[model samples]
Target chain A: MIRPLAGMARVGLRFQLAYRSDVIMSVVALVAQVFLLRMIWTALYGGREHDPQGLTLEALLAYLSLANLQAFATTPIIPRIAHFRIRTGMVFFDLSRPTGYLPQMAAFQAGHTAGGLLMLAPAVPVVLLVGTITPTEHPIGYAATLALGYVISVMMSLLICVIGFWTLETAAISMLYRLVSHFFAGTMVPLSFFPGALGVLADALPFKYMGYVPAAVYVGHLSGGQIGQAVAVEVGWIAALAALLWAMWRRAHRRVVIQGG
Target chain B: MAEVVRTLRLYWRLQRAAMRGALQYRLNLVIGVATGVAYQGSGFAFVWVVMHTFPAIGGWSLREIAFLYGLRLTAHALYVLPFSSLIGLDWLVREGELDRVLLRPLNPLVQIMAKRLGVGQLGDLLAGLVLLVVALPPLGPASALFCLAAVVGGALVETAVSLALASLSLRTWNTIAVRVFADDLFSKFGSYPMSVFGGAAQWALTFVLPVAFVAYVPASVLLDRTGELNVPAPVAYASPLLGVALFALAYRIWSRQLRHYQSTGT
Candidate 1:
């Protein structure tokens, strides 16, 4: 089992390595986004008290810089995988293979994610030097939270992708997903700044688990109690989503109907 | 002169047909519009959150920011509605679909632009106007005129910038790359107030990208914040010039591509 998973990981790395051009595109996007956002937040907090929720402008910029770096890292490859499966009738074909479907999916995703993290190598140095930063108070703890957040996000994202199998029309769902990610993840603006009812609502959802929570934690927004609570909720949500995904995939396999070519 | 008229007339007919096709799925269209509203509507919510945090950005208060938001949203609607069709022209060009468009009596560039109207964009238009109504503060007559002119100018700039970016795919082999870059460029910067950007970045938006013409400059005029830009007051008032020049240039460049079009039939 471990060997197959490692093999799959190797396959993902090789595939990602071959995608030289696409990787370049994403790296350019990451840099442009970080720099541009730095400018916006600079204006947002310039000469003013950016002390809302204890947010220093420099910390917020660093948070955003890391947010952009992690944006694509948490994707559920299951959507594209689902697209190919449906188009090729491979969901049933996969059932014939000698492996647990759920683990198979997880292994493949982990492989892809590992490759993506490897690609993030370029960002580390940039963040160290060029990227705006808050003084690192709990660098190791922050890394742990970020790592856990990536895991939770990947699970939830895949859970959403699995919905593609059940719902033929994913356009609206996709739009909602993209839009939610943009705003809730602190990609648009930090959650600390959100207005009354919506702000409270934004806090409860797993949306912040994608970017904001990790960022907030990195910059010391969540205290020890608050961090514990958030991480607990995130882990609970991840488990719930993973279970739901497994059940749905099994049901979907039974209902699979292939049309004539 | 005649060419412009004919081009406009053809695209108008194509738009009507496109609208009818879209209208066939009335429920879907309604849902699509609802989705679009929800999609953009959340930004206001997020902006509201930010206001609560800091009260104002770059000296613009929450209410004033809302006004800017409306202007920006409306500009985006205008950008999407009439010229959303221009977004896919690069795909047509890359696929050699232009050959068929060229064979017709009408100019291929115009025909290609005329084809594939996405009426779903009107949802964006309606949402924009609705936002404008909700966001605009009570203003005097002069500011009102300025706001109106800004909306018009913003729309023109957005369309021109979008189409110009689309035209780049004609000469460049990377159509999707250019297309994605165009959408991201306009949508990202256009949402925020210009003051949010630094001096060099602001200049790029004003002179280079001109995305700020989508809402920032003219709205600033109405809001009485001309000090934002180091440029003279006239430059802010003349925001429409970039849009006009760019739109005309896009079509010209697209036309020039017709001379070298190697249709896929080959």
Candidate 2:
């Protein structure tokens, strides 16, 4: 399984590299978003030590930049693949393949993510030179939490994609998901920055574990124990979402087989 | 002149047919519209959160920033309602659909655009209109007229930008990334007053992309909120003219690309 997945990852990497312009365009868009967010936060900082939130200007800027970087670097491709497969009735072909559909998808995404990191390589220098990259007191805890957070992110995307089995207007489902996730994931704004009530709502949602917790962990916002708790919570979400996706995939596969579509 | 009028009439007929087809999917239409409103509302809500937390952003008050946001959204929806279908050029080109479009008697651009009206964007238009109406106190007649003209101008600039980038799909074989990038740029930047950005970025938005003319300059001139910037008084007041000029340039680019469009079969 590991060897085949590694091969699939290599294929995904090559495929991503072949689309040089897409990669370049994504990087360009990432830079533009970072610049736009940087300007807005700088303006909000208003040359003060910090707003009422107690975040130093540098700290806030650092958080904003890193959050965006993380998002761009780890953009989920499985949803897109699943979307295409379901839309074009290509899942029928996948079902007949020797490998398990879920593992194939996971391998493809792991590979694509590796390729996407190349696009983000240029931005790393920019973030380091200009951004406030907060290092956590507990590097090991941060790494573990970050990895777990990524698993939860992937599972969430898979669930959204698998939902296409039920709806012809899958784009709508994906768009709605994008809207909700971007808000709750702290891609648009840090979860900490949400108003008191909205902050509570964001915390309740699993989306924050996708982008916010990892960055928070890096920024020392989460203590060592809190990092452990965050990872545990993320693990719980991963298992729950994985189960949901499994049940969904089973029903969808049965439908495809029975309908012969 | 007669030819242009005739073309416009045909386009209107095509649009009406598309609308009837869209009406069949009533639920989808509702969802689309609601999604549009929700997306635009989120941006406004983000601004609200920011302004409520901090007194002002770049010296623009909440109401003033809301005005900018509302104008951009309204203009964006107006442009999208007619031309959003053009964003699908990548799919059309890839599927060899453009060959069929090229064989048609009508102008290819017009035919492509006339296939669908973004009825979903009506929600954005309504939301933006409500926000603008609420944000502005009763304006003088002249100011109101200017605001109306600005909305038209801004919409034209936006549609022109989409068309210009989409036209490149003929050569690039994929223009979706560019379209997405442009949308990201406009939505992220358009919500705020341009003066907040650094000098170079502000200049890029003004001259290179001309997005400032879409929302900021028009809002500034109409609201009498022009501040310490190097934008000349006359040029800032000529936003409508600027929009027209930018659109003309984009159309020229599209026209040039059309001539370069060789089918994959060819």
Candidate 3:
């Protein structure tokens, strides 16, 4: 199983790397995004400031910049690809395969993300310089949380993509995901800044664990016990999502009506 | 004159067919529209959260910013309504569907423009109108006409920028990322006033990408606060002309790129 997964990952990595233009474009897009965020935050934090929500100006800026950078690197294109395949009737080949569909697709996307992150490495320096941010207190701990965050994010995206099996309206599903995540995922603003009801809603969503928790841990907003709890939540969400995806895949695969060919 | 009439007739026929095909997926269309509403709702929620926390940022109140947001959103909806098919140019080029389009005895670009109707933009249109009504800036006949022209201009600018960026597909054979990058430049920055940005961003939004012309400048004119970003009143009033000029330039570039296109032999 590991061997097949690894092989699939390699194929994904190579396929992604071959699209040199996409790699370059992603880098350029990330840099432009960092600039945009810097402008917005800098303007927001003009002069007289008491750090709202217990965050210093520097910390808020750091989290905003870093969260955006991380989100940019981790955005999975597999759903879009899956949509295209399903629409073109090419998904039939993958569905007919004997391997566990989830593992194969996950490994493939993981590999693509690895390549994508490599291309996105320049964004780190850009963020550090523009945001004037520093390293977290516990580098290893931050890494662990970030890995979990990536897992949950990828799993959630896969769940969204699996909707293609039932309906080729995957773009709408993905757009809905994009729309909700902007508020719920704490990508656009810190979840702490959300008003009472909205704050509660953000906390309840799995998306916060994907972006907010990881950035918060890196920025020292979550420490020790808090970090532990966040990771546990992320893990729990991952498990729940995995089960949901399993059920969805079973149902969606049954309804797959191959078109074109 | 006869050629113009012929093109218009063809566009009308193409639009009807496109609408018919799109209506076939009734559920998807409904979901798409609902998704648009939800999308706009979240964006408005973000603005509400920000303004609620702070009275004003960059010397603009919530209502003022909403005026800006409304103008931009409605302008974008206007663009999406007629020309949303431009977003899918990369796919058409990649799959060689463009070849079949070229075989038709009409302007390939016009056919592309007429191919898909973005019915979902109706939701955005409604949302934008609601915001504009809420902002409720003082409106005289001249200002109202100015506002209407500004929205149309904003739409033209957006369409021009999208077309220009998407035309890269003619050479790269894949320009989805580039097109997305262009779209992001507007949606990300168009919400706020140009004064909020640094000197370089302000300059870019003014002369380079000109999203400032889309909403912020127009809003300033309506709100009676020109030169806030140092844009002259004359240029601010020329938003419609600017949009038309930019679109004309972008279309010229797109036409030139079309000559470079080689079929993928579907």
For DockQ, the strongest prediction is 2
Model 1 — TM-score against the truth?
Answer: 0.88
**Tens-digit lDDT string for candidate 2 (A1-261):** 677777778877877778978888877777677777778888888756635566666666776677777777666777777778777777777667777777777788778888888866876877655665656567787678778877777777777666766773466777777777777778657787788888899999987876788777777666767887898888888888888888898887666622334
Model 2 CA deviation exceeding 4 Å by range: A97-99, A130-136, A246-253, A257-261, B89-105, B164-180, B252-266
Task: Enumerate the chain B TM-scores of all models.
Answer: 0.89, 0.95, 0.95
lDDT of 2 at B162: 84
Q: Would candidate 1 be rated incorrect, acceptable, medium or high by CAPRI criteria?
A: medium
lDDT digits (tens) for residues B1-266 of candidate 1: 99889878987898787778888988778778887787677767656666665656777887777777788878777767666666676667667776677678876555655565555566666767877887787789977877777777777777766665666666645666656665677766776777677778778877787777777777777778888765688987877565666667766766676565564553
Of 1 and 2, the candidate ahead on TM-score is: 2
RMSD in Å for model 2: 2.8
Best by lDDT: 3
- Model 3: docking quality category: medium
Candidates 2 and 3, the one with greater DockQ:
2
Q: List candidate 1 segments past 4 Å from native.
A: A3-20, A47-50, A87-90, A127-130, A223-226, B1-6, B25-28, B139-146, B264-266
Q: What share of the true interface contacts does each candidate keep?
A: 0.60, 0.62, 0.67
